[model samples]
Target: MAVLTGVSHAAEPLALCFAPPHAVAPDVRSQWQQELRLILHHSGYELKLAACTPESIELRVLRSNPRQPQALGAARTSQSRIEPVVEIYLDPLAELIGTRLAGPLGRAMARVTAHELRHVVGQQAHHQGGDFPEGYSAGLLLAAKPAHFRIR
Candidate 1:
């Protein structure tokens, strides 16, 4: 079943729709998109969110998450289409910047986004560890290179 499931999505591109928060600087947003593109591309995924076309996955960067305050983001299968919808809270991720971890909000957002997308794409029943299920690491998020945020 797992093998079949993996095969089913192997050739499909990750066509997602998401926009950066309005408050972010244009350069920051552009850099974030490029960084995430590098990560996903290196990990064997194609990112099509820039076009913002209607797609199977949608991501939103919300002001805050009252239900799960500490969490950076979450994902759920959309009830209407059974597709994945991802929600990321900007405040919590923004707070991490300049802390002991020390990182930019955009990079942190990308890291969290990558993690949540994996659960939906993999249809993971359990987070076996490493990146998913497990919390994001400041070290990984703070890294200069983008290849470390692997989806699988």
Candidate 2:
């Protein structure tokens, strides 16, 4: 599931939209949004909530497994000639949460979102490693606590 953000110029504000899975609690979604904002802020970016379309980050939810792939979330960089569309899968996160209803899935998911955004916003065509500007290993990003990556 790719959310399309048309060619966003530097002059336009960075905006985003939560696709579906409307069933998710507002507070949970808000919490996730706040987490993402904090992460992006530390990375030197501002986030704005936008409509479902017309140039914005589309947050979409997908089945846990899209053919038993290893990645928990993926971003579409080639979808548009310009800005890429970001998508995060919920199934793997659900698996990690495993029967624990109180697990930090929301927080984890937010981290995944931030990881993808780094690729799109940072204009980084390739990942450095398991960290961000430092490098990014999806596995490490998903498994570690948010505190692990401190703000500079």
The Cα error of candidate 2 at residue 143, in Å, is 7.7
Off by over 4 Å in 2: 1-13, 21-23, 79-83, 97-103, 133-152
Candidate 1 residue-wise lDDT, 46-148, digit = tens: 8876546555577787867898887887886554332477787777777655441223666677778787877777776456764554666556667646766
Candidate 1 ranges beyond 4 A from true positions: 1-12, 19-24, 50-54, 78-82, 99-103
For candidate 2, lDDT tens digit of each residue in 1-152?
99878855353356888777644556656767777776766555677877777677787767554665556666676644325567777666656555213235566667878877766666566665445543345456546766444322
TM-scores for all predictions: 0.73, 0.68
| Candidate 2 residue pairs in clash (backbone atoms < 3 Å) | 64-91, 129-136, 130-136, 130-137, 131-135, 131-136, 132-135
lDDT of candidate 1 vs native? 0.68
Model 1 TM-score, all chains together: 0.73
lDDT of 2: 0.62
